[model samples]
Target: MENEKDGELLSYSVTLNSQVVEESKELIKSTGGKLSPILNNLLKKWVEMNKVNSENKE
Candidate 1:
């Protein structure tokens, strides 16, 4: 499948809290969603919010 990565993708592994993972899995299933875009959007929003807040504080 074509991804937002423009056909080039990277993979890595990390350890996460099992409880967090389970909760996230339930949320994803309930939403009928996938992980990649959700995570990407969340990270993007986090960065944008941080930038805006920093600017406000400056």
Candidate 2:
């Protein structure tokens, strides 16, 4: 599948604690937010942070 502007989409299976999943779901629901975007933002931040760290080590 292709995202609106982020290119191709890849699917992966992940496991998380059941309690955490439920709590996150509730929080997202209360805020009218979806999980995909939240996860994407978090992953993007992680990637950017790692890139900066790698550059600093060079």
Candidate 3:
């Protein structure tokens, strides 16, 4: 699938705690969502928030 923010798709690996992984899996299944896009959106929101905060401090 194409990414909305940037028209590119990339894949990588990371490690997480077993409990968090299990909960994330259940949440994804219940919400009918995929992990990659969900993580992408979350990271994007985090970056945006940090940028806004940084700008406000200046």
Give the Cα error of residue 3 in candidate 1, in Å.
49
Candidate 3 Cα errors over 4 Å, as ranges: 1-35
| Higher-scoring candidate on lDDT, 2 or 3 | 3
CA lDDT for candidate 1: 0.49
lDDT of 3 by residue, 1-58 (tens): 3464232211111122333445555665676655578675674455556555544544
lDDT rank order: 1, 3, 2
In candidate 3, position 18 carries an lDDT of: 32
Provide TM-scores for the models.
0.39, 0.40, 0.39
lDDT of 1 by residue, 1-53 (tens): 56646333321111223334445556666666555786846744555565555
> How many clashes in each structure?
0, 0, 0
Residue 11 deviation, candidate 1, in Å? Answer: 35
List per-prediction Cα lDDT, in the order shown. 0.49, 0.47, 0.48
* lDDT accuracy of residue 51 in candidate 1: 50
What are the per-residue Cα lDDT tens digits for candidate 2 across 1-58? 2463332211111122333445555566565645578675664455556555544544
Candidate 3's displacement at residue 9, Å, is 37
Alpha carbon lDDT at 47, candidate 2:
50
